[model samples]
Each structure stands twice: as C-alpha cells, then as structure tokens.
Target: MSNVLAIAGVTRILKDMLNDALVFGNVDQVMGTDFAVTAQPPDRIVSDNPDTQTPHLNLFLHRVTPNAALRNADLPTRSGDGALQMRPTLALDLHYILTAVAAEELHAEVLLGYAMQLFHEMPVVPRESIRTSLSAAELAGLGSGLPDFGTGPLSPAELADQIEMLKITPVALSMDDMSKMWTALQASYRTTVAYDVSVVLIERALPVRPTLPVLTRGGLRDPETGRDPGVAAEPHLATSVPSLLSVAAQDQHPVMRLGGRVVLTGTGLDTGDAQVRFREAGTDVSLLLVPEAPARPDRLVVQLPGPAALPGGSSLAGTPQDPASWRVGAYEIEVILTDSEARTAATNRLPLALAPAISATAVAGGLARR
Candidate 1:
C-alpha cells in the first residue's frame, strides 16, 4: 500500500519516463513547443491569451475509480511504538487522457502516437525505477497541509512497495465517449489516447490503533493461597460484566436495522429477573435505551422500535444522524441478572450492531447507498 501522494507521484513518474524515452533523452523536443507534460485538467490548462499558448502533452487524469475487489484492503503493520496499526489503502484506476495540443496537425498526431508507443513498450513500471526517480516527499506526500497519512517522513522505497507493479493499459473509448470527453473539458479535440493506470494506492490519515488499555491485574490470589506476587495469569476475568460472542441467528449476521430483528448470542446470559440493556458505542452513562426482548440463557431477541411490546411498553428508534441513534452504529449490550431476594450481577459488553447488515443486502441496492 502506498501513501497519500502516490496518485500524483505516479503521474510525475510517468512524465519523467516519457521524457527520458524521447530521442537522445531530451525534455524540450516534443512538437517544437516546450514539452510541458502536466497532470492538470484540460479545463484548467486552456487559456484565452495567445501569448502564453504553447503546444504540450497533457496526461490529464479524467477519473479516479476505486478497485472494487480491494476496496477494503489494508496493511496490518505493528508500528515501532507497539501499536497494532491498520494502515488502510484504497486501490484505484487512474484514467488518463493523453491529449496533445499543437498548432501543426501532423505534430500533434506524432506526439500522441509517441506517448502511446512509450506506454505500450514499458507497460509495467518497475519498483527500482519509481524508487530512483520519485523523491520521498513526492512519493509519500506533497505539503505539510496535506496530512492524509499522518506518517513521519516515509522513505521513497516504501511508496507503492506493498502493491503490484503499476500497469499501464490502453482503454478503448468509443466515438460517443470521445465526444463527451472533449465536451466535458470544454477544449478543442486533439489527438489523444485513453490509458488506465491500475492500482495507485492512497492511504487515509485517521488513526486506527487503540491497544488493550487493561491487562492482567498486578497481583492474583492463588486457589490455595490468599495472594501471590507478579501480574495475574491470563483469564483473570471479573464477573462484573458479560462478553458477547455474536448476534443474529447462529451468529450468521452482525447488524440489525432499526425496524429489523436480531438475536443477541453469547454465554452466561442467564440470570434472575434477566433483562438486556443497550448503550451507545463510545459512551458510558447511567441512562440507556433498552430494547424490549425475550432474554434467554444463551440468546436474547430484540426488535428495534415498532409494534414490539417492551418491558414497560417502551421502545425507541433514535434519530438517524446521531451515532447514538438506533439507526446508526453498534450499541453495546449487557445482560443484567438481578434477584431482589439474592443479588444483582451484570455481564460484560456485547456490541449489538444497529445498522450495517452482514448478508450485505445493504450493499445490493439496499442501505449501502445510504
């Protein structure tokens, strides 16, 4: 996976490659005008003034479409600081229109053909080439303002290091699409070829590492002795809360919509005067939104507010935008077993997914659009 500037870096690297591939490896030779190879949009490149006009090769990125198969691809790297950092990466297809603008018609055709020829011959961009050509700042990121990776001075070699060799392939554009392309750019049609650069990785900056805040206790009492030295052995769990294994029937799903029903599956759920409690994900407050459900020994069925009869004939479907809303994210669930004559005990946290569906019906013209 590459850093934030990998996309722009790929464009710069390509420009460099084509310039080097030109006859005698010269930069100011294409079409007698300055070989101005730019990645900017054609709309922004065009100007009304004739004095500043110059023939050039514009490798304009018309579109950036994400690769569906690797949409959620990530790198699980243990940071030097011991944080289990999940470095996220998005695979994308860079659609570039290699447009050649020249006063001489023949020169424009020659420039476009040469650009196509270069890519056809060197279809695969080598790691060594990208590593040697692109600087660390260009490969990792551009400016201090763009904190898209939150990483500190990543090396050039690490850019596009985890992904496959960047492949350049010609994309067939019909006459209609060609017309639309020129129309959208609001520029005159020029000799051009559409090419797709596969899998330029762009990583996000948000932190995804949060280590286990609490470990084993400092001292643990042995079964025979009252207490012992050193941290307690693993599985030194206190029975103050419950731990949930999963949700949905047979644990096949993890999400349930506001009006949908789901099964909260786990262990140690049985208790006197048993009732399941719901709390928002990232919050610790006394007030909770409890869903009406039939609490059982191993499972509890809950239906988000509708025609369901709750303990006190109360049900709720919190507002949509609020993360604490029943329509939003995961809700932490706990089973409370309190016997007035005996004692009261609550289990560990078990998150009840409020919205995202597991069968992914949500993605298939479902809530995925939302």
Candidate 2:
C-alpha cells in the first residue's frame, strides 16, 4: 500500500512563496518538494534500518473522484481500519494549481497583477481588457466578497460631463469696440473725466524721490529732524493725493440712453458739494452743471440722467452758419471739489468734442453709394 501525508499548511506556504517571489527574483527552491514535504533531513540516516538511509519523503496527493450509480453487485465494505480502501492518484503541479486558483478568483488575479507590477517591477497590463474577459457572475462577485473594497462614487458619465465643462473658449474684441466699451464705462457713471495735465507737469518737475507728509502715532512729525542720526528712514513723504483724469464721451452716438458709479481716491480733502459741469464745446463761461453730489468729504457719489438727446435741430453738415454744424471743441467744462475750509481741493478741467449725430437717411445713402 502506498503511504500518503496530507500537507497540513500548504496554503500558508504557497501564500508566502508568492509574496517572496514578488519581493525577490529567485524562485528556484520554491518549485521544489523540499518546502512542502515533511521528513527527516537528507544528512540523517536510520541506524536500525540501513536500507532506508534517508527518511521517506512525505507527499500530499489530491485527486477528484466522480460518483455514479452502481450495478446490482454488492458494494465494497468499509475497512475496519480508519483508512480508505480506494486507489490513490498523483497530485498536480503546484504552479498549475496556483494558475487554476487565479483563474477561479478573477479579482485575486487582478490584485495579484497589480501587486506584482508594484513590487516586482513588472509591466502593467490595462484593466479594460481584463474586465471584459471576466464572466458576468465573476464580475458581479469580483469585489463583493471583500469586506472593505468599494466601487468609486462618481459614474463615468458624470466624469465625462465634468471634463467637458472644464474646456474654455476665449472671446475676442476689436479696438473700436474696446473704445466704445470704455466710453460706455464713463457714461454709465456721473463722475467727470478730465486730462490731469498738471499731474504730468508736476511728475516731470519733481525728483525721483520726492518728500511726502509724515504721519506718526503721536501726530504729524516735524519735517526737519524726524529720525535719529543712526536710524535709517524712508526718503519720500506723502503730500498730494494721486488723481487720474481722462476724457469722457457718450458711449452711443446721440446719447440715447446712459446710466453706473465713479471711484475717486484722495486724502485731506472733502468732496462735499462736488459738482461736474457739462457745456457745449468751445464755450467756457456758459457751462451747464450736468450733475451735483451733496457734501461727502473724501468720497463723492454722483448719478447722471439717462436717455439724453442731442441739442435740437443738430445738423451733420459743417456749415458755420448752422449752430449744430459747429462741431464741439476743447476746454468746455470742469469738475470741482470743495473742502470744509471752502478751499478748491481738487479740480479737473476737461476738453470735449461732440460729433454730429448721424441720421438714418445718411446711412441709407452711404449703403446706396457702397
């Protein structure tokens, strides 16, 4: 009778072999029976049994037997000894068995592949084809047996939508359109736009590092000796408030509609009762106060009425006899700000030019000419 030894811990040994194979490249001894078979060492010999110098190699053999109905003959009786009387079969190779196990556990195969790639420096195989190769039942049970593994939160469609929304397109604008936009910006606000020629002149006259007013915790510091001899000090002091001025124009020709806010920055000056006057070009003395804001020192808020129409009976023809034909010229109006001391804290003198309103008839004629 052939003796067989059941491998008590083959599963754990196999798992260790797989883990070590991922960490180390040598698999020479892993394939040998020495790791699985339990027996005396090869160097040891039995003293009483000289013929059996080395111990017999214990082997674990497994075979699948099929059950079927037997004919009317008497069946074999069980042996009195607790051993089976059935014939034994050879076991399959461990590597082949492991391959079969991986095929049976598809998710384990994927996880093994990923682990091998990470630990063994193996090339990665794409997951899509592997997923497609799995059967419906196998795919359903892939991650279900695992206690903590989870399918991701976002669906493929949602990811695709987010990716599509991330793409951006740039918008382009022409110079004339940009100018019109700036004009609209100024027209939307009631504040005056003027050329600060005085600032430009002053900047040209002053040195690179100019003196400014000094403010201290105690109060304003004395100008002559504000710092100790050994201490470093700032070169410039704050004096006049920086102001920006520019020409303002109606965004749309004929000023059909207009209505937005003006931002001003300054110090030591009150804008209480600040007024912006708009006048016909070329006339200085006869100017109309277009808008006015009640005393609010340091900041002024103003609003201009909308849907302004050109002066009545304006003509496009440049005839000197026609008041409308006389195009608007420079130095027409000014913006003035008054402080508590009744002083003119800030002033912006603006030069303006008004273009003659174009009529529908002229547009039609121009199209005909074209």
> Per-residue lDDT for 1-370 in model 1, tens only?
5766777667777877765665444534645556555667776665577456665677888889987767765545667886757766778888888887655556556666678889998899988888765654543453322233324564334554855779999989999999998898887777678889887776655676676775444434445765544542447554424456766632354565645655766665665666656677676532233434556666767555432223433243233312333435667767667654355667776666655533323565556432
Model 2: per-residue lDDT, tens digit, 39-145? 22222212244432221211111212221222212133224663444323222111111111111223234333433343234222122322232223333553322
- What Cα-based lDDT does every candidate model obtain? 0.64, 0.30
TM-score of each: 0.47, 0.22
Residue runs of model 1 more than 4 Å from their true location after superposition: 23-34, 46-53, 73-85, 136-157, 204-370
Measured with C-alpha atoms, the lDDT of residue 219 in candidate 1 is 38
Error of model 1, residue 113, in angstroms: 2.0
Model 1 earns a TM-score of 0.47
lDDT of 1 at 345: 69
Q: Which residue pairs come into collision in candidate 1?
A: 241-347, 241-348, 242-347, 242-348
TM-score of 2: 0.22
